[model samples]
Target: MSARRTSRVLALWCPDWPAVAAAAAADLAPTRPVVVLHANRVVACSQLARSAGVRRGLRRREAQARCPDLYVARDDPDRDARLFEPVATAVDATVPGVEVLRPGLLVLAARGAARFFGSEEQAAEQLVDAVAATGVECRIGIADEMSTAVLAARRAALVAPGTGAQFLASLPVSELAVEPSLAGPERVDLVDLLHRLGLRRIGDFAALTPAEVASRFGVDAIAAHRCARAEPERAPAARPPAPDLTVEYPCDPPIDRIDAAAFAGRLLAVRLHDRLADAAVACTRLAVTAETAAGERLSRIWRCAEPLTPEGTADRVRWQLDGWLTQRALRGHHPDHDEWTGIATIGGQAERPGASRTRRTAPPNGSADNTVAPGRAVPAAPIVLLRLEPVEVVTAGALQLGLWGGEGEQEERFRRALVRVQGLLGGEAVLKGVLSGGRGPAERITLIALGDELSPAADPALPWPGRLPIPAPAVVLVDRPEVILESAAGAPVWITDRGLFTADPAHLRWGTKDWQVAAWSGPWPLDERWWSDGHADAVRAQILLRDDVMVLLLFGRDHIWHAEGLYD
Candidate 1:
């Protein structure tokens, strides 16, 4: 708090932001469920998956069964992160210091920025324009804090400051990410739970004490608490520095020679120091402007060696000019008659409008101007060629030519291989461990993201429960089993590797095999997923695998079953 009101923050949320962004680089769509699983392994299901009735945590079998027409795709977090870099840069241009909350989220300090850039709304628009340059459609949210800002963005509209809590109060409880709980035959969704608890909206949640919520939900209550009323944290900026003085020298003749450009920079620096001395302020960024002789212009920004004074500034400028002149003179690129004329400007606006930090500028060594006379006009003001503007602040990321070079593709593959091998060698290797909180083991089987923890589905068997359902077969075959099934008095007919027979019931023979139905159970009926569009889970059945184990099978959307799940 620089004697100013608390800093407001802006948070932007990009919708479908990951896949939508992936589409820009490469089209990866073909009717499959696309979920962006985070480093935390929580899946952010795509809209396509939702339409198919596949949700974030449905079992893999159930999801596929729900929409046999569905596809499963891996989520790329880094790609998602890179997609928003340009947008982040754009925001940096409009308002420098920004903290990326997530791949599709941005949080920026708004207190001083709002005042310096005008109003909160004006700054947001400017930021929007900057993001527009990156060709992204983003929803901007501004509020008193990070949490409110996030809610604002999610709502897909601007929410006035001082009113974030009210706006948040209007969204549904499900929007906060709640799970259903098993009570009777059917469980209760979070909305019902909230209603049961007598809490209406997020605002209502935000109003409760964390202790009160914890008493009921346990640790999960914390997340619920956040959902009810959570705000993200802001970046630190105690006393944001404003500039003491900034002076610009417009060039008449566009500057081309390093010597001439250097001279102009010196003059501007001198003027800047005089003003700074008067106002008693010191800044971090030094902006240099080069207006070309033909009106084509270039501006270079730099930081200072220290709290720069006019004399120190002039020496540095002369040194820079001399180096420029030498480079041109050696290459003979300068005209035999004309010299480049330009102006250099220096000052601070928000620490450095484009710079991420307030650091001093240091001219390269071995290139200082040691030949300038004590008192000499390094050429009179060339001309009002262009109005010089200081260069903005720059971070290391901005100056790079390639994306952040982390590991190569080969290295990544090797790492994955190593993990797999290590796991197999350890013997405790469980490739997939699904939670069957619902029906049986087969139904509980799940595929985990390589490093993610497996979670159990909601507990569906309760109230009157003592026995556990047998797990389904791990591997399923599309072809009916090659065997003949005959009742106490009958001959075999159908035969295949897929299974014994359809619900119509007729077993068969295979290879040199023939087996009759002795004491058999049922083709226990499993319904197609009501959630999925194509009826994935519509036709599922269970069978006893002789005496070995019980196997669950599915008559999937594709009319196939490669054995579903297996029981212990």
Candidate 2:
């Protein structure tokens, strides 16, 4: 069988949807004048604002002059999709499947729905009615091609299967720029130029031969011309039905730490992908769901342009958890005052001011509750369960591979070797170093698993006042080692209270022996987080030992000397 579905498609579009979505999010009445702006120009205007002479493409000043009381919302892609998701879900209930072209528009197989509903008109009616019940207005159109269907829907009219071309020919060519499926920056420009050339109707554009159009206008224009002519659309080969691929993990001890959640997400992503690989499939869309200890549920579906590998899925899950945790932190009671029971310090001493002790709480379900130490900031809600569901699947073999003799095979072998090492050493034991943004040598690098998500240890983009001038050190000791800095006469070398070095020549001693410094550089001072309690004030000096070894020494705060790095 031909992999392509029938040419007939049904498109559903919500007119002025950005404006509608913004109004809904703000809980404003639909009759209230609203305008959505992008690049300081009106992108979408509500019916109320439209009546006041506000239309798309008008500059912000022009829009305000036309409608003095316009409630203008800045365009946000995430907000648009988040608000539109409910509408798509409502439509999916009536149609067996729906392909979302964008937030405001979608297309589906018309023949199957029409046959099931008894007629194309009835199918469109059912879809329109379903979306309307969600409190958003929609118009549906059925035509033989997706592009034509989009225009037909704007008019709320269905074109007979074979008459899509005739129906589209009468529409203005400007409508081509309005169809999201067919319109892009280039195609929009083409439409404008076509209007200048007096090809004002789809009929005029469709009259040009495909070859001539391709030769002169380029690829996107050729696609638009084909749509104008109602040419057949050849979809990729159909895959088998999605498998019952779902993986769930119970957080026996609810997870409240963002780092803990990220680790768990990575493991779950790996397991989920392994299961799909066993079934000879790959995931295109993934649904992540989490249940909080308070019985609240959070779920989101993430779609990928390419099949989501374990790393990509893990990253998405981690990002979602971060957002949820951040929001909870912002809205919930002060976490710094929470009665956390356990204290787990990673690599450094407790820098923040406070002493906390851990206490174990027994729950009715017999699960151990692991809470942070009291008087420490933490996520307000702990996740009790995490679930991963593969929403869309594709045949694994269908994914294109690199050409033969390419590094693809070598890379696969290298990955397999790393996996074997991980299996031997335990999952978290074997790690790969990843560079992150940071001014300090120790803070700029992090370690993660070979196939796990990569995130920065510290944001390098922030203004760091006391950053050391680089030529970064080749070797950074994982732990800062306490040392003693002394002058030639055995007097302690120190940075004066005025942020100046006490002496010129210096010797360093860590254990029992002392190393004479052959040459040294001035102390570069840094004071960080001065506005907060427990502020750090330190000075670093580079020393070249007589043994031809170079090292960096830090002095300040508690008057302690520590070896920060080495040039080894």
In TM-score terms, which candidate is top? 2
Q: What does candidate 1 score in Cα RMSD to the true structure?
A: 20.2
* Model 2 ranges off by over 4 Å: 1-6, 236-568
lDDT for each residue of candidate 2 in 1-568, tens digit (9 for 90 to 100): 1222355788899988888878876777656899999999998899889899988899999999998988989997656664565565455445544666667887777876777778888888877766765567889988877777888988998887578779989889988878544555677889988999999999999999988898888667877898888777434224543546799889878887778788888889878877887788877667677787766565655645356677767877776565455444433545354553222111111223342333324321132111122232233568889989887778786444445321133456677887998899988867888877765777778888777888667667777666777777887877888888888888888788787778875688879978888888867777766899988777777888887865664544567777888876
By summed lDDT, which 10 consecutive residues of candidate 1 come out lowest?
Answer: 342-351
lDDT values for all models: 0.47, 0.70
Q: After aligning candidate 1 to the native by TM-score, how far in Å is the CA of 358 from where it should be?
A: 18
Writing each residue's lDDT as its tens digit, candidate 1 over 65-117 gives 77675544447644554345445434543454555444567666676456766
What's the TM-score of each model vs. the native? Answer: 0.39, 0.48
Clashes of 2: 3
